[model samples]
Target: MIGLAATPEVSLADEPVRIRAWGLPPQTAITLRAWVRDEKGDIFHSRAFYQTDTEGKVDLEQSEATGGDFRGIYPMGLFWALKPTTPYRRLIKWDVMGSPFLVHLELYPSVLLVPSEDHLPAVTTVVERWYVAPGVQRLQVRDGRVRGALFLPPGEGPFPGVIEMFGGLGGLLEFRSSLLASRGFACLALAYSAYEDLPKFMPTVDLTYFEEAAQFLLRNPKVSGDGVGVVAVCKAAEIALCMASYLPQVQATVCINGTNAVNGNFLTYGNISIEGIPYQIERAQTTHSGAMQLSFTLQDPRKPEYQDCILPIERARGPVLFCVGDKDQNYDSLFFANEALARARKKGKQNVYLRRYPGAGHLLEPPGSPFCPVSQSPFFPLPLMWGGELVPHCTAQETCWREMRDFLHSNLAPGTKSKL
Candidate 1:
């Protein structure tokens, strides 16, 4: 008889699982495979080759993968190393209120180059990964102009508030915000464009709309803070910077792998309008995979003509955390972050912090999320190369997520007890 098991079987998405196998031949070579289907029905899977111990047991916590998707003693490697069955299909969870992802684990008798349906597995098991913890509440918000889903932690008198925003992909993304609520934050996954009745594209960004969302979050009876934090990635990060600079209600900002300048859209606030930095699409290179490498496509904002495009982040009333992936193929995120740092320092702002991750990508999601270096873009004809090696990128995601949570707790909640 053979057995495979994942401890607890069900847990939060960020929580680690210990996988072990037994009842195999001593010192036998075997393959461990993990597979899960996304909300869109796209399958993602990973496999690793390992050798059993003298006692005929294999523990992911102790054993190292000798071959396959990843090497080394990473207990959760099977989760993060998952690659799409079809190229350029990024894994995204659209339904946070639904059932958790059912990850199927199988132990094969031999080391197969690809998962074979022809042969039965020696052992099989399943694990459930959930974004929302038990008792967390999810509420849809269609107030005024704010279109989002608000996630509130359970047993809360009032919780620290955070507004989460995603990039140019545009629709509301709730997975990260839902996970934040599980960690004791009242988070709003806000959508600016391409969702419901919102604009189809962001040709002009109205800072007033974000201001309205921030105001609405602060007015919530379940939200404790007089001010809120904004966590944004990609093009939305630029909007976060703008909010931090212009909105006094935005007390903290987390900018992840985003530009410091107005990007590809005019930012408007009353009489103030900042022109977007121009993109040299002609300079973009197409890789052999047919994905466009856009790292060098955006014009430098520091240039004399584009100086006006740079956001005045020194005007921000609170500390700003800038997280950048050094190997970001989406754009020069490190360069933009450093430029923002310099500009802030020049204006005598001392609360700005920069965290740089080596070999990481543009989509630095919460831990346990798959590492997608390239994926098809909803806005583009071909795929986009987001850029990063799997191991280092996954490592960065784990580390960055912890730090980001701590940062939010310290700045937004202060004396409040944290569930993380």
Candidate 2:
């Protein structure tokens, strides 16, 4: 008989979950694989081969994970990085419908073989919720015009507050916000469009609405600090940068795989109209597998009309952290980050920082998320190509996640220890 178990039983996504196997044949080589269903009901699987010791036991912690798309003793969240061979099938799919992806992990023993339903071992299930954390409370946000959910950590007093937002692929993305709360930050997943009671699509919106949301956090008694921080990914990063520049209450900004210039169509504040940078779609060369591939290439920002779209980082109240990937397919994120840094430096601002990861893709998710090389279009079947290989992507995710946490902690809750 072969037995497998994951230590700690319940593990957070940013944290590692150790797997141990015993009761197998001694000194024999075997294959182990894991299978789980995504929120879309697609079954994804990953497999690896390992040799059992004389004791007929295998501790994954003691050996490196080899013979798969990833390798290393840990490989920084290998469990979550197992993606489907079919493109556009993401390994780490965030729930945009305000629900958590509950992953049931099953380790199967088989011959040195490929991953398939037939090869899956008949065993009991050990389940783990992907982004849900203990003691994190999710509250529906309906405060007047403000929308989305608020994730509050379990504490009596105030905590550092953050307003989390997603990019053009709009929806109520609460996983990251809720996870941040679990790590001790009061996070509000703000939805500007593409959800219930919000705008059906990205449109010319008022920046004052966001300002109102920030004011809400600052006024909340449970929220610590005099100002709030903003965390955003991709297109939303542009919004975050703009907010930091215009909103006095926004003291810190985290922009991940974002553009230097404004990318949204138009942002209005009274009579002021901020036009965004324009971009042309460049479809990636599709492979024989018929996988979807798409990339957005931005036009020249030096143009006279585009000049006004450049973000004024010198006006920002606090430091900015730009986390970018060199291989970002959506846009020139590295170039954009460098531009932001240069502009801030030219303006005599020393608080601007940049972290560029090689071989990493457009999406810089929380640590331990699967490396999604190809992104599936939410509205259509065409897939968006996400640059980067598995190993470096995993490493990038871990490193970026750590740096991001530190950035927020230092800016929002300076001199305090990480709640990890």
RMSD values, in order shown? 2.1, 3.2
Best by lDDT: 1
> How would you encode candidate 1's per-residue C-alpha lDDT over 1-420 as one tens digit per residue?
788999879999988899999999999999999999988888999999999999899999999999999999988899989999999999888888788999999999789886667978888999999989999999999999889999999994588899999998888889999999999999999999999999989899899999999999999899986889999998899899999988999878899998889978898998999889878899998998789999888888878988888999999878899999999999799999999999999999888889999999999998989999999988889999999989899999999999898888888875443222
**Model 2 clashing residue pairs (backbone):** none
Q: Which prediction has the highest TM-score against the true structure?
A: 1
Give lDDT: candidate 1, residue 124: 92
Task: Name model 1 segments beyond 4 Å from true.
Answer: 414-420
Error of 2 at 277 (Å): 2.1
> What is candidate 1's TM-score against the reference?
0.97
